[model samples]
Target: MIDDAPGKGRPTRSRKEAEAARKEQMKRPTGRREQMRRERERRNKLRDKQLAALDGRGDAAYLPARDRGPVRALVRDYIDRRRSVAEYMLPILVVILVLSFIPNPTAVTVVFFLWSVTILSTVVDEIFLVIGLKRELKRRFEPGETKGAVTYGVLRSTQLRRTRRPRPTIERGEPLRDRY
Candidate 1:
């Protein structure tokens, strides 16, 4: 019972009709609203994927321009692998504020001293971080590629590790790879 013709048992379309159908299938949405809807969907998908990657659930290809490349990666790892005085500044400031509220001259003096020391340590720590990071950047990458890297790393170090963007790839005190 061989009932097959060319395209199963259905009547065949002319060549022009088949070509038109294929073109229609491949055509982009004709209306502006439909086009915008499709574009929005694509952007949403990209954004979600990027966020997932930043959270360590997806590939790193979707990382934003600021966080991409080996230079930035090295900077982040360098900052994340060690403790910085800046990391404690926020909590210390909070404590200092609480202590400042006491109705005592001693408390005020202690708060002032604590504030000065904290700020001084943070600045010194940042300077050291910048110097070390610059040295590493020079060893690993060209000078041109490392523009703003010191500042970027310093800013990242200033934040509490738990609150850092891109979420600290390596644990504290972990060793960095020889090459990024």
Candidate 2:
């Protein structure tokens, strides 16, 4: 007799029956198509999470290695606090673009001159920022602590605060406290 009471062993199907059911299940689209759909859904979710990580919107644990760690966070804060020529570049470019639509040759010449100056100034600022950032990082961190930080700082410096991914956490002109 089968034991149907609590803690009793569950029922089992015969080998032939189990094999037949398995074969039937495999014949349906719910087999391969369902698996592929699940896989695609998983990938889409993972892609969204990764994008959020890139945007600096999620927990620090999910951040990319290039952007992770306290020292890198401090470097980002420092660059964001300072006013950068590169930061103004986007706005100036937009203005120049609008000016380009005017019919006057003088406007075109002015736009060219403005673009040249902005580019030159931004290039010079980026150079100084990289040097200073590297030196400061060296002073504050061990040799091993600063891998890829120079590149990180240079890229961060060029991005405008408003448009930067993983939006700026620290306020503009705010002095960085010794958080390291």
lDDT of all predictions: 0.89, 0.82
**Candidate 2: stretches off by over 4 Å:** 1-58
How many residue pairs clash per model?
0, 1
Per-residue lDDT over 75-97 for candidate 2, one digit per residue giving the tens place of the 0 to 100 score: 88879889999878888999999
Model 1 earns a TM-score of 0.81
Q: Candidate 1 lDDT, tens digit per residue, 50-76? A: 998788677778888899888888998
Clashing pairs in 2: 55-166
Of candidate 1, the 10-residue stretch with the lowest lDDT total is 1-10
For residue 125, give model 1's deviation from the true position in Å.
1.3
- lDDT accuracy of residue 90 in candidate 2: 83
Q: Assess candidate 2 and give its lDDT.
A: 0.82
Q: Which stretches of candidate 1 lie over 4 Å from their true place?
A: 1-26, 30-36
